[model samples]
Target: MNNDLYQEDIKQIKQQYACLDLTDDQAAFLLRHQNEPYPTHTEYYLNTWEHHDYEDHIFQKILNTAQFDHYLERREARLATHIAFLKQQDEEIKRNIEYKKQLLSYYCHTYVPQLLQTRLQYPNPFFAHRSKIRYIKEEYSNCCKVWKLRVTSQHFRNCRNYSPQLFELHMLDLQLLNIMPDYQQFKADADMPTQTTLTFLLDKSRCYLADFISFFDQKEAEETRTKKDAAIAVFGKAATSGWHIEPLPESNEERSNRLLFLLLMIEKVPDNGQANSCY
Candidate 1:
């Protein structure tokens, strides 16, 4: 409710959404609808994008969150209902966690102790106490922020390492995660022009997002065609189809950013191979 704090949080929201290449109209939509959930940072979207490392901010907001989290959630606005729904999910998870803590602690002290004593064996102190402690410890493990992270292993090469005004490949996964919904919306609507990465909008020289993505797309296509053509030319099937893409090259970290989004795109797909980029 404090006007000063409200404005400051709004600044954070704007900064977080700045990575996307939005069209004039899409930009206006976000500009008008920017006043929803108040997050200290946008990294949370990285996890929600199915990278499995979602434990970042939810716990901090909900751990000591009994009174405090609700206090912030009470701040009202004519927000995008989707964002509000996410906030509500956070609240529900928080309540469930708090309830689990209470229930686990209560059973750890009371009926569980009595149940252990009931066992006719000499003594089950390990089951009654130590095992219980271990179970509780494992239970709390689920409360962690880092669930499963697979992207740290992957890497990619791009044109430029340093682009201040534009979103680059190294940072694409983070911003792209947030705009996946907008990407779908763009497909359903006719006014938006199709960009390679969907939600991404292009600017002057900041990073021609469509061209950049297509460059990789076409390059991969050529390589696939090249190897397959060679293989089919010889016999029924080639011994190796994708051996050329191997032999990874190294680059400067400070000046270069890997196209982590490629890995992220694969991550979104189902292991059963039933879906094309799970989106």
Candidate 2:
């Protein structure tokens, strides 16, 4: 055969022998002596006797056993690295959540109480009235920002009376209502008929007379209350319907009366129409 054909045949033979369990030196020897004739069977056995000598062989086996061990080690190392990364991320998330919770608790326990106490001590009726409206405006603004952040079209909504103006107006209304008995006696002696009954008059009338405007509307007090009631009816379908009633003490103590009056004023209105006219 030509040199090219001979080379091709040798390549194929080497490929076949590559599948055998032969050592590097043995495969090299076979490739080098491929063109030589085989010796007699007895002489061949004697010449290659060293390969059979397992304990004192010159050439080692070239099996792929260690490759599997190497692959297993790599896999184990990769898994260990991945597990460590997950653990680190989990710990960081937990720490961040705990920090946020502590911050919220601090605000609720300390900041809110201090703010309420300060307002109580100062008792600026005008400022308190204005502050309620400002508070509602800020809350609504915050809700709008939240809606934007959440990428939602729905408007942020709240029913809680956060406005300082409204709060002060309610306080004033409560004070007036508590002194109604005295006002009635004075009016009776002066021979005058009151335009409205104290218990039947809506708190919104007081809000209107005192120039309290809703954050959403700057309309007259009667109109504002009408719109508010309508809105509440529509949106507050899922809201709770119960009066936060607290009994007034049977004492003429000024502090007790003031405390009780304030408590009654701060009590939330029920969802239904019953007692809705009261502050």
Candidate 3:
């Protein structure tokens, strides 16, 4: 692994590749990499001066010359390999970048605006969702529309308004309750309001586990279809408006309860949206 085994060969290699103007460094590179693979650069470097016991001055004279000495054949080959890898994975890298970019755009334009909507003296279906009479809306309207509700988040610097970050965190909490052995008991605990709590759970009866567990799925489908019809009547034009009613992702009892929780929260918001509004 050290230069000891390669000590004798260094001179021989320099002599063989001399036609290519090999330096002591280049000869050492050729001697070590003659096998053409070392898992990666780490493995190749690990077997260098430390393993070889070559004197510091001797080793320094012949270490990694290809980076500065372009004449070294390995330099061109390494660059070519890296460029080829970049080209090969370009599409995947682009998709990943684009996905994050879209998430940021959503955060800026949709999520943050909703949280601050109440302070803007706005009405339901947020002002930001529009552009000069456009019916701007949030992406997911299947559940209790947070933009249409008055939820609070204590974690985010004591925020109190329509907020999706709070909404998602609440959703995970609901999912947690849904998977528990005594889910109803946990759901009940989440329902009971605590003094000084930012969030107030309302209409806890609607979120009863029995409704989802005992009811036939056909009944749920029928209700879903009816809601879709109403949504079409409200925000039908896909070309202009950004909403259409569709099936919620396949959900369990927990998701059903989550939707019920959102609905109850929306219902709890006062009817007087503008008159003496919080904004």
Best by lDDT: 3
Local lDDT at 243 for model 3: 28
Clashes of each: 2, 6, 3
Which parts of model 1 have CA positions greater than 4 angstroms off? Answer: 1-81, 123-279
TM-scores, one per candidate: 0.18, 0.21, 0.24
Candidate 1 structure, TM-score to reference: 0.18
What lDDT tens digits, residue by residue, belong to model 2 across residues 1-279?
787876666666557654344444544555555566656672234311222243122222333455334434554665566556644654444433433333333333443344345435444442444444344333333433442333221111111222233333333333223222122222232212221222222232233322221311232233334433433444353322222112223453332333322322332223321122222
Measured by TM-score, how close is model 2 to the native structure? Answer: 0.21
Is 1 or 2 the stronger prediction by lDDT?
2
Clashes of 2: 6
Pairs with steric clashes in candidate 3? 2-52, 3-52, 129-136
Q: Is candidate 1 or 2 superior in TM-score?
A: 2
Q: Between candidates 1 and 3, which one is better according to lDDT?
A: 3
10 residues in a row with least lDDT, candidate 3 = 133-142
Order of candidate numbers by TM-score, starting with the best: 3, 2, 1
Candidate 2 collision pairs: 129-165, 131-164, 132-163, 132-164, 132-165, 133-165
